[model samples]
Target: MSAFAERKEMIMTKKTAYEFAYITFAMFIISCSIYFFLIPSGIVVGSISGLSMVLNQVINLPISLITFILNIGLLVIGFIFIGKEFGAKTVYTSILLPVFLAIFEKICPLSESLTHNSVYDLVSYTLIIAFGQAMLFNVNASSGGLDIVGKIISKYTHLEIGKALTVCGMITAATSIFVYDISTMIVSLIGTYANGQAVDYFVGGFNKRKRICILSEHYEEIMKYIMEDMNRGVTIYSAVGGFDKTPRIEVVTIMTTSEYKKLLNYLHQSDYKAFVTVSTVNEVIGTWNINKNSRKSKQKEVSVQ
Candidate 1:
C-alpha cells in the first residue's frame, strides 16, 4: 500500500481496538453489577437479564445461559430488521456480558445477598448498570436484548431511543410481578425509572459543553489565553453597549467543562472586573478542530518563541 493508505489502515485498526476495549470494560461493569448485587437480591431491574431472572425461577436454568440464548436470538432479529450496523455494534457486548457473568459465577457463586439490605443492592446495581449502559450508548453500541426491540421500534415509529427503551423496560419490569412479590415488583419499577435517570445523567454529562461570552476591557488577554493556552477557537464580534452606547468587543467561545473551569480561574486571577456570561450548550457543530497533540506542540512552540 501507499504511505497514505498504510497510515489510514493503522488509524482504523487503532480506533477499532480502542472501541472494543471500551465496550469490553463497560460490559464487565454491567456483569459485575448483575452478579454481585442484582441477581442475589432478585431486584429485576428490567432488561433481558431481568427477564432471565424471572424465567430462571421456573426453568431452573443458569441466568447466564438464559441471557446468552436471549441475546443470540435478539442478534438475529437485529441483523434482519434493525440494520447491519446495529447488529455489528451489539454482537460483542451481547455475547461478552453473558460470558463475563458465567466467569463471575464460576469464580464466586452467591447463594445469598452481598449486603443485608435489599434497597442498597438495588440502588447500587441500578446505578452501575445504567452508567455502563450509558457508556455503551455514548459509543454508539448497546447491550443487546431489549435494546434491539427498542431500536426496531425507534426505526419504524421514529421515536426517540430513550423513550423506546423506557417503554420496553417498563414492560419487562411489569412481568416481575408474576415471578416475585409485590414489593419486589415495586422495586423493579423504581429501579427502571432510576436506571433511565442515571443513563440520562451520564449521557448528558458526557456530551455537555459550555458556551462563554465575555465583555471585558481585557479582551485581548482573555482571547490570548483561550487561543494559546487552552487551544480553543474564539469568535470576536463587535458590539455596542446598550446603556453606555460604547463600542466593545464581545468574545465568544465553546469549550468543555474542564476547560471552562480553568478559563474561569484564569479570568478571576487576571481580570477580576471582566464581565462574563456562561451557558450550557447541548450540541455544537462546526469545522473547527481541536487536536490535543497538535495543541500541545503549538503551545510548546509559543512558549519557546
Candidate 2:
C-alpha cells in the first residue's frame, strides 16, 4: 500500500481507539461516583438510582435489585421510545452500574453522613453527578432510567437537553418530597439545578472564550490593554483594510464575553476607529481550530424533532 494510504489508516485506527477509550473511561468514572459517593448515602438527585432508593425503602429491597429491575424496563422503553443504539449502551451501564453498586454496598459502606453537610454538600454532590453525566452525554451514552428519558426527550423535543433534564429532575425531586426526606428533596432540587447548569457550563467553558479579530490602525492600544492589562493571548495577522488598499495589522485577541465587553468599552473609549468582528467561538480543539461543531441537540431531541 502507498505511504499516504497507510498513514490515513493509522490515523483512523487511532481516532477510533481514542473514542472507545474515552467512552470506557467515562463509564468507569460515572459508575464509581454513583457507587462510591452517592448511592451509599441515599443521595438521590434523580435517575434510576433515585427511584431505586425510594422503591428500596418501601419494598425493603436493595437499591441494586431495584435499579437492575428498573433498568430492564427502561432499556426496553429506550429501544422503542428512543432507539436501538441507546438501548445497547443502556444494557451495559444499567447492568454494570447495579453490579458495581451491589459489590460496593456489600464491601464498602459509609455509616455516618458527610460531616458538616449543608446546601453546599448538596450542591457538591449534584455537581459531581452532573460532571459524570455530562461526560456520558458528550459520548452519546446513558446511565439508564431518567438518562434514557432525558435522551428520549432530547431525541424527540429538539430543544436544549440540559433544560429538559432540569425539568425532569425537578419533577422527580418534587415527587420525592412525598416519598423521602423533604430536606433531601430540597437539596436534590438545588443539586439538580446545579447539575444542569454545571453540565452546560463545563461543556461551554472552553468555547465561551472568544477572539475578537479586529481590523484597525490603533492596534497598539488594544494590544496593550488585552495583553498588558488583561493578560490575554493576542496574535497579529497581516491584512489589507477593505475599502482602502492600505496594508494594515489586524489584531486578534482571545478573551471571555465579560472580558470582551470590558475590552469593547475600553476600545470605544480609547479608540473608536477600531473595527472589530466578534464571532461566537464553539471550542478550541488544538492550538487553533475553534470547534463550533461540538454543541448540538442530544440524541433524544433528535428523535422527536
Using lDDT, give the best candidate's number: 1
- lDDT digits (tens) for residues 192-256 of candidate 1: 87877777677677777999999999999899999878878899999999999999999999999
Q: What's the TM-score of each model vs. the native?
A: 0.78, 0.61
The residue ranges of model 1 lying beyond 4 angstroms of the native Cα positions read: 1-12, 52-70, 76-86, 150-163, 178-181, 218-221, 224-229, 268-272, 285-305
> How does each model score on lDDT?
0.83, 0.69
Clash number for every model?
A: 0, 12
Write down the lDDT that model 2 would get: 0.69
What is the Å distance of residue 254 in model 1 from its true position?
A: 1.6
